[model samples]
Target: MTEPSVPHAPTAAFIGASWLALVAGAATYLIGLFNAEMALNEKGYYLTLLMYGLFSAVSLQKSVRDRAESISVSGLYFGLCWLSLLLALLLLLIGLWNANLALSEKGFYGMAYLLSLFSSVAVQKNVRDVSLVRQAAPAK
Candidate 1:
């Protein structure tokens, strides 16, 4: 017989989510800032978002496989991440092509950064939850 596994409390979950968000947000911000010159061209923004979407999809799949459990929260997170990235890319393109949109893009980018941060944290939490559930389940 196997011992039961412990799950994190809601408070712990909130703290963990916040920390993950902060770390991921900072990392993404730095990556974008450092690579702006090389990576922020009209087409590059779309390409970058596309790449992120693809990578996230793969990661989500791997997480599901590792957990051996279906978690709708994971799917929700990936969808949000892709949506946020697409919005950011669209705003970036508009900024490049239109002056008015350029001003909005600045603000949009900031919000997008926040969204990315939150989404990262959410995904992390969901993955952890799924893993815990899988571990706690009795052997078949």
Candidate 2:
């Protein structure tokens, strides 16, 4: 029989970096939005998208992990998780594409948005992995 896996803690550097990247990306995006020449309504739209993207990304990551581990994940929920992630991305792309901002501003927003999404996923995965590892460990 295969030996049981041990619960290993995440490296301090990885955890710290993941958190830092997430914060930096999100902060940069928001700061850009706050200083943007767009109307308040436009700012609201982008802010909502960011919130939705972060939530959906994390949910998708968790659902994916659950499926990978053979845990029971409902098909509808799983499908919704995927749909939300895609929709969020599509919405961001469309918004950025149609905005009147200069190419540089557009590029900056796009990069920040993508960085935030990617870092959020990484953060979610790291948290989940650490949780599972701890749960598997015997009480000392």
Q: Each model's TM-score, in the order given?
A: 0.35, 0.92
lDDT of model 2 at position 46: 97
Give the least accurate 10-residue stretch of model 1, judged by summed lDDT: 64-73
**What root-mean-square deviation over C-alphas does model 1 reach?**
10.8
- Clashing residue pairs in candidate 2 are none
Across 42-136, the per-residue lDDT of candidate 1 in tens digits comes to: 43554465346434544554455444544344666766656665665565446445533445555644655555645654666566666676777
> What CA RMSD would you report for each candidate?
10.8, 2.5
Per-residue error (Å), model 1, residue 112: 2.1
lDDT of all the models against the reference? 0.54, 0.90
| Model 1, CA-based lDDT | 0.54
Model 2 segments beyond 4 Å from truth? 1-7
Maximum-TM-score candidate: 2
Candidate 2 positional error at 140, Å: 3.1
